[model samples]
Target: MSQGKLSPRQKMINLMYLIFIAMLALNMSKEVLSAFGLLEKKITNANVATSERNVAFMESLSTMALEQPEQYAAVKRKADQVSEISATLDAYLGDIKRQMMTTLKAEDFEDFEVQDQPDFLDQR
Candidate 1:
């Protein structure tokens, strides 16, 4: 038979093959998209947490500066160091998210919560 000729059985089989291929394509695309979303979310959350920590530490340093001028320089230095470390950690998290597989979801990360350190007066 010519290439144009197809029996009913052959047509059915071809249709089934096409449907199967489409489903596989859809599933794989979904997985890839989800992976990208997961990575984006992780990077964003890490960035936000680091930013909050930096702000809180900076505020604490400023408080120390106001309360004890004699220790202002030391407090400022420590705050700077903390900021740098936090920035480095944020960058590393971004890199890890970029390299992680799709199977790693947002649930894998612990919730990012900042706890305020107790002031000396509060310890009494």
Candidate 2:
């Protein structure tokens, strides 16, 4: 392993080593990207579940308010306010996502295979 000129066999071994290292790096990158995609999907699913639960809870509040207006009406009003705010925020965030997709020229962010430019977002 001297710094001096090496034999052809040694040079070939070094080139192979370099190639192997590059391959490992590429494989690791793909695995990391896959993990990120899976995480995003899990988070999206959880958000959907949470939204469903919130809707169910809101419905129950509506029922309670109708059944006992004296006690639950105020509570229902507050709940309705929260729901309205949530809807507004959700719409704002959705608009932001649409803008991002438009800027990226992406049909679907979940389709990682179609995303070729890793630095597209960075450039913006």
- Give RMSD to native, each candidate: 17.4, 8.5
What's the lDDT for all of these models?
0.66, 0.80
Estimate, for each residue in 62-120, the C-alpha lDDT of model 2 and write its tens digit.
99999999999999999999999999998998886676666454455676544445454
Which whole-number lDDT from 0 to 100 does residue 15 have in model 1? 100
* Clashes by residue pair, model 1: none
Query: What tens-digit string does per-residue lDDT give for candidate 1 at 77-102?
Result: 77788779877996897675455422
Q: Where in model 2 is the C-alpha error above 4 Å? A: 1-34, 105-108, 111-124
